[model samples]
Target: IQAFATLFQYGTFDRFPNLKFVVLESQAGWLGYLLDRMDAVFKGPMGATTDMKELPSTYFRRQCWISADPDERALANIIDYVGADRFFWASDYPHPDHTGDYIEALAELVAPLPSDTRHKILCGNVAGVYGLG
Candidate 1:
């Protein structure tokens, strides 16, 4: 599993530099685990040989976004760790697993964040990523 994780991490980003990837429904807590391992690999001998200019976590920090259901407590706890800029709130509406009234829930969840951060996550971030504006 360890080897596979390492290889998969490198391969995914390597193959898709322009890909605006978002991990949907994957709880945000796992992102910290992935980042830690990727950072470790970057500092180790394996990193020196890679074609990537920056550490894998660096790539993730800049290029990746993740969606979490509004009600996911684990996601709430880890939001700061992953950087709020890279997170998008998802209603997963009509899906049984998603909480109803996700917009309201998201508003509440992000209320304490800086206004700029809240504005970005609530709308501007997705718009920028998807080229909507």
Candidate 2:
């Protein structure tokens, strides 16, 4: 959260517009709260914090991606809060903690989302972010 706040406070994204950031292992459920608070602060007393061309949420949506554990119950909700195109599934495989089939869990979690959203979360988002074709 601090890293994202600092980057936004310093206009990092505005300076290096094409730089992409992928946040790994950070369960994506809290982004909505963080962004909401950040925006409130940005619009309040500390509005002069930076010469940011846009709000923190705007930069995040444009230049960042976050990975969600396949078994996260809030995944679909998180994907909705933070654009579906900004998320991808992650499995803490071989980590001695995760269990079961990651693919199966992911498939089930994304079943109710639209096809395009599911596709992006499954693969398209990551590929596009990294120029992976």
The best candidate by TM-score is 2
lDDT of 2 at 40: 85
lDDT tens digits by residue: candidate 1, 1-133: 3543554445666777777776776556577887788789878998776666677777777778877667766654566777777887777778887657776888777777788877777787788889999
Error of 2 at 98 (Å): 1.3
- Among these predicted structures, which one has the highest lDDT? 2
Q: List the RMSD of every prediction in angstroms.
A: 3.2, 1.4
Which ranges in model 1 have alpha carbons more than 4 Å from their true place? 1-8, 11-16, 48-51, 74-77
Candidate 2: residue 19 Cα off by (Å): 1.2
Q: For candidate 2, lDDT tens digit of each residue in 1-133?
A: 7876788888899999998988888778888899888888888878686878777889889998888887778877777777898897888776666776887888788888899998998889988988899
Q: How many residue pairs clash per model?
A: 0, 0
The C-alpha stretches of model 2 lying farther than 4 A from their native spots are none
